[model samples]
Target: MKRRIVMSMFAGATLLASSLLGAAPARSADAPAEFGTDWHDPVTAAPPVAKPSGKSCQVTLAEAQFRDFTPYKGTYTPPEGCGERWSKVVLRMDGKVKGRQFDRLGHLHVGGVEIFRTSTPEPSPDGIEWSVEKDVTRYSDTFRRGQDVEMLIGNVVDDTYTGVIDVKVTLTFYAPSATAARPSATAASPVTNAARPATSTTRSTPTPDPTPDRVLTPDRVLTLQDGTVTTPRNSERIVAEVYATGSGGGCEEFWYLSAPDPAPYSCKAGDGPYREVQIEVDGRLAGIAAPFPHVWTGGWSNPFLWYVTPGPRAFDVKPIEYDLTPFAGLLNDGRPHRVEVSVVGVPEGQSGWSAPVNVLVWQDAKSAHVTGRLTGHKVGELANSSTYTPGSEHRVDTEGRHRLTVGGYVDTSHGRVTTTVSRSLTNTSAHRWTDGENLDALDAAWKDDQSVTVDGRGPARTTRTQRTYTMDGSITIGAGDRLRTVLTLGDRAAVGTTRAGRRIAWSWLDDTVEGDASWTLNVPRDQRHAVGTTSERFRLHGSKGCYDRSLTSVQGVLTEDRRAC
Candidate 1:
């Protein structure tokens, strides 16, 4: 597949940026019976990063090859021509690999802000390429000045494993329109560093308001240094995002399938198949959210199932966002405060999880110091259970849930602002496997709900969000020594915002993937006759925009695609 460039992000940029996606081509009359040296490149059905219509600037962030754990480190200078303020900022990463290799986890960080997290695809004998695009406008605060950069895609190379990951990352900045320009919005200026060389960050024109809230992303993004954070004294609002992943090819990589001690299972954990990400400030519970159950390309004990179409969000990992506004009152003391993150269900003394955090704050413009009190902080009892049933077909049924609510008031420049946040989470699964684990399957679902209300002298503004994730599949070794897999995965969400009990904006999203693959087991690469089919349907619509489409592939070829909606 040919790579797309983000040279000019104007009209038709979205379609042009649809790398390895869109409609399929004419099919051949005959199909190959055996696995070949090459196949179609990997692709996903997620919507492309929407670009605005305007002049744009592009900067190469990093380029490197990974053969070990050492990370690629460098420096990033702001785009020379792009204005300080922009309507949007888009991130694109293109990668290619060939020969033999295992799937590898990757990360990209700029000035300590983890902007992107992903996993690589196992390469074919010949070669394959893939691309990913994500909207990063909210990080405009971090891009307004020079910063340090780092990236890593840990891999290994030997006589047998030969594939070396090659990738290039870039950022595109789109200029704001005349009406969207914020000429007078410079009351809160961008961070200034005298040691760094000046670039386009110094602007004469007004910058756009990237978000409704006065976002104040610190120039030096925090990484929870010793589980501590020091926010501005005048900060009136706070939010934190966690890019958490379970990996290392150990039991944690397939964390959802792990079982508690003595379940006759190979992998054991203190808790089974249920996990939660929690946030705390000053040793008090502040916020919580559910982490997405992510599956890599080599997941489900079958690589053929994902050689063409991957599961949702597999290519572009998204961070779990937490509204910590209720803790602003306590964090606005100018002194360092203890901040912590913990995954709820992992066993003690075990290692295999990584959670990097980025804290975002909004400061009061008129006051040098803002102070108040945390009125309420409540945490519901955690509900978790795992039942093991042993028989011809051993089974484990598990259920876990938790809830938290926090309220506080911060005296800002405008007035006293009271904020309340409530969040809840639930996870349930049925894991079954035959004796010797010849046949294994899992059916699981998870839900994360959040609501935030901001009350001041005017009508209160509220935002509500409900997110769901599901996985149902099975891997079996049937007659004739044939190994097969049938699986389905889903990622969906519904969001709404209101004022004074009236809806102002809303949106819904649903992305589903299904596949069936089979091949001769315990055979040579050429001798194993492999066959597989995968399809994805993604639909999204609401106040911002609309995207509805479906794609299908057979024998590593995209067979059907249409924007039917």
Candidate 2:
């Protein structure tokens, strides 16, 4: 039988959790052939946030339990004695839940800045505990000042769904090292945080970053009002982050498997399953990216597959970032502009997806007003096509791609800086299933390629980021009416920075998770005889450093924990 997993996702004060639980202890003896009350506290192979070994200060951000639809609201004050400057700030959330519940989405806003967005884990009958930490140093500007805070992990508690999400979030600020006042060379320096490769990427030989010369944050964060925002008049660089999620506990949660008009499937989209996250600025196309196909814990018609190990980023959802710098000139005009974010393939008004936008701007400090214009903006026609074939096994083949190029310039205090951005997105998928849908499966992949360049006084600099997301899985019911799920997910990227014609800094990352499980289709919890295996491997190498770690579990017991670099 499955063993009751009593593991803490956190490994002690090693991660700013001075009093948090330690690592998972040795697994208990395997029981009969059934799942247990709780599996391992949800954990991923992703690298933990890096913290400097210096004096640090902590501030309780929010302590609340989510129930119903009401959000926890309060005020946040900067940590005293930590000074206004810090080498790094990390946000950690410790949580516990019992009874039964489905996975839910959540977000945290500080001073109106969206510092964190994540999804909850479906709890076990025996209850469960988990923790997650993120490096939120980039938002130091917003954290240094006191402001209102709001957080929500919307949930419904009743006789059937009886789990309450109890969570506490805190921020730890690490004092700058003795050399923090010293200026050091930055291999990837253009956009201070651009080098970050989302989750699963680690610096092999991370160096303590010096105190930022200029606070590397938006002076003002504006949420779209009817898809519109008024940026700072002297904005030098602008970026928009989309907290996109396809949820609502429905087929839309599996949007990529959606079939077109005639292809019989659970989730159907008139235009097929080609979804793209697109942004328009000032009534013009600005950026386009493929949304990360997120599979929640309660996904794939099977929960047993994820009880021990969620997908690659199930617990830590990273927002999609778009370089809106090329549009800084037009936005700096001091007037409100229509900056809208939309998913291209959703049914006109169907509410399966939720994408809230947060626009961040880097202003030109020396100039009262920066003037410039969009010299060129061009977008290739979006290519989307799908084909359907019916048989014992129905099949739908979908392919789509889009490209965009935008260029502009702004006259700053230092000089005239020209910015150009080019991005391309492609998605392809195959969906197949039997007549009764006893057999359902989908194999899909998405690629987003981008390059941003800045040309001013020194050698022209450019940063290139290439990301790939893949999902391949199948859930089937056969003899004895047993349900089985076998799935694999991949999140990978290659980032490189170049100045003039020389490559200065670069990094490569790959994180993959796989699971397989089966159980009686219509049996009670104890009679299901559920069995499963899950594994994840994460690796990163580059100028930043090198790291490789892997995790594997059978039933609810962790069988392998290995790291190689």
Give the best candidate by TM-score.
2
Show where candidate 1 strays beyond 4 Å. Answer: 1-31, 181-221
Output the lDDT of residue 402, model 1: 94
How does model 1 fare in lDDT?
Answer: 0.72
* Model 2 weakest lDDT span, ten residues long: 6-15
Q: Candidate 1, clashing residue pairs?
A: none
Compute each candidate's TM-score over C-alphas.
0.88, 0.90
Question: Any idea how many clashes model 1 has?
Answer: 0
Local accuracy by lDDT, each model:
0.72, 0.73
Write out the backbone clash pairs for model 2: 1-31, 1-32, 204-545, 204-546, 205-545
Error in Å for residue 529 of model 1: 1.4
lDDT of 2 by residue, 1-565 (tens): 1000100111100001211122544544343356677676666666666667769999999999887878899999999998988888888899999988877777788876677876776788888888888777767778877999998888888887889989999999999887765231111233422224232323344421111122354555667766679988888778788777777655567788888888766577889999998888876888888888877676776676676677866766676778787788878877789987789989887877777777877776678998888888889989999999999999999999999999988888878888888889899899888887788788999998888788886888787778899999887888897878899999888777788978877777787889998877656667878888888887777775566777777776666667776
Q: Candidate 1: minimum summed lDDT over ten consecutive residues — where?
A: 7-16
